[model samples]
Target: MLKEDLKTVNEVSKLTGISVRTLHYYDEIGLLLPAELTESGYRLYDKGNLLKLEQILFLKEMGFELKQIKVILEDPHYDMQKALRKQREILRLKSERLHAIMALIDEKLEGDEYMNFKAFDMKEIERAQEEFKEEVEERWGQTDAYKESAHRTSRYKKEDWQNIMESMNDIFKALACHIGEDVSCKEVQDLIEAWRAHITKYFYECTPEILSGLGDMYVMDERFTNNINQYGEGLAQFMDDAIKYYCLNRL
Candidate 1:
């Protein structure tokens, strides 16, 4: 490890503030492997390996599972810069949420009579949702469903959008409460049917094919998954499975 561009595993651990044991575990799991091993069997990481490690850490911080991160990083067409930009946007949204919560806390401390600490402003949440929608459109705008959704939503007023978001959140909360129910059960199916109708009413006519694709996105897209899982643990995957069942059996 005489090379200036190479770092020993211990040095990398110290520099990254990650425990050596964890790094070893990552290596063992094939998530991150050392660039080389010295004659004395010391693990070494080069500059490229360090950059990959940075990406792994960033994704981990963003709540991605280790296996998911590995799949994303190993994809042949993975866009590093795009991923970083998305991560930055996620951090920005989190910062905004934290700021809003802190402001409510401060208002409570100051005895402000108007303070509503029990809930967040739906407007802010809707704004973040709109931003994410725009991002999705930018990435998938060539698809017919994306174009249809954009056209359908083009005339919606702010208040209309707010109502739509509120309705969606309500549905999510209801579904979260029924998490343990079978996806094909009548109650869950009714809720999912209503969800489908809601999407068609607000965005576009969501056909079974389009709805199925959205279900896959719910599980595959981190931003969407995070939003859904906010209602409850495993809620995103649950929603995905329900959507798939609805599309297959009910459609």
Candidate 2:
């Protein structure tokens, strides 16, 4: 019995540019299955199945995990209009993040020529944080760390900045002597405390969670990783471990 909306698996694959194996897998997973099977056991998709497949591919391209998408699509209360609006909102957020990253890249390329580029020091960090306080407040809401950071930063001095850089280098030198030793040792912990004290001058109000996140950023951010690595080979990893240990236990 021929159906008006029916398409054989081969025809559907050709039309959608999806492989036959993938279609079979989707059928096996119950993500998308054919409405009918022929006398020869050939899979045949209907118009509704094709539409569902199209929606799945669209969601996939938009970064939706398969399980989340399945829940979204299968929900009795699912509204296509609402789903599209949510997707648009998320894409907007991604666009804004991308723009900010591009601006940072441009600042790096321009270096000293950047109009608002402040030298990376305790004073500049304080000033910049103050400038962005409203935005940060909006994101994190009222928190002790945020309030404390604002208070701590107001007292940051130029001499403090120079001491921080010196102390950081001194700590790195000490750690280099015992490269493979436990980073959580008392000696390393003290060095981390000194480093943390310096950071507190700029970002005193940050929570333990935020501190840990910054430790991850030290290695994840290529620019920061490069700076530490330039001190010595494997220095970046060592510094990452030290920071992680500090944030985990002592920060």
Candidate 3:
């Protein structure tokens, strides 16, 4: 690559409008890394890095959290063609929504007596987007890492599984009690650390990267959200935020 092909971190920030701190956070979580670092520790992103960042941003726009995007991008099965196809479907749904709203407005301008609120219904759009995201997640879940987790857990008897569930529930219950507190505080971060450790001990490696993905899953995956929220209202979201802060700043 030519020297001119590289752009500094600051230049990337200005061009992409992503904060410098966020870029650093992404680097920390193993989501995105600079193509090269100068002798003095300056980050320089090449075309490949920028292209990867584009994939990340595109997934982010589709409402997938940063951690989910990381997994999707890191998976060996990831294909830019597949991403483009997903983006095309999302955009088409959006365009249809816009056209529907426009037609409704035109009807109103023509003095229609009935008001149709169906144009604003988001259920179909949300359902399709969720399905698309799940498609990506399903593929990623079949990777060797997940298979490892499964293989390890499959050996456990019912009581062992019960113990694991109880242990995990205890963590959620404790986190629920601290729901109203600042998630970034040391107390909360310590809990986040324990949570990561627990997963590593019981299931898989649970590296900072994978832990971040679990954090997003707590909120994005309805099963997790529902189960976690049962401990306390909004507990899942609080844990998600705390986990993110812990991953970005602590780990």
Listed per candidate, the RMSD to the true structure in angstroms reads 21.3, 25.8, 18.8
Candidate 3 at residue 160, lDDT? Answer: 66
The prediction achieving the highest TM-score against the true structure is: 3
Model 3 C-alpha lDDT per residue in residues 1-251, reported as the tens digit of each score: 56797899899999999999988877655567675568897888877677778888888886776756765664434567768787888788888999999999999999997979989988877887888778876786567666666566546654564566567777877888899999998888888888888877876687777777777867765544655676789998999899889988996
Pick by TM-score: 1 or 3, better one: 3
Best by lDDT: 3
Cα lDDT listed for each candidate:
0.72, 0.60, 0.76
Question: TM-scores of all models?
Answer: 0.45, 0.39, 0.53
Ranking by lDDT: 3, 1, 2
Error of 3 at 181 (Å): 61
- Give the TM-score (vs. native) of candidate 2: 0.39
Give the alpha carbon lDDT tens digit for every residue of 65-116 in model 2: 5544443453323344544565556556556656665777777797745554
Tens digits of per-residue lDDT for model 1, 1-251: 23776788889989999999998877665567665567896788876677778889876765556755654553323456777787677667777777888988888789887846545645654565466446534555455555566565555654565577678888998999888788998888888899889988876677787678778777775645655776788898998899989988998
Model 3 TM: 0.53
Clashing pairs in 1: none
Selected candidate, larger lDDT, 1 vs 2 = 1
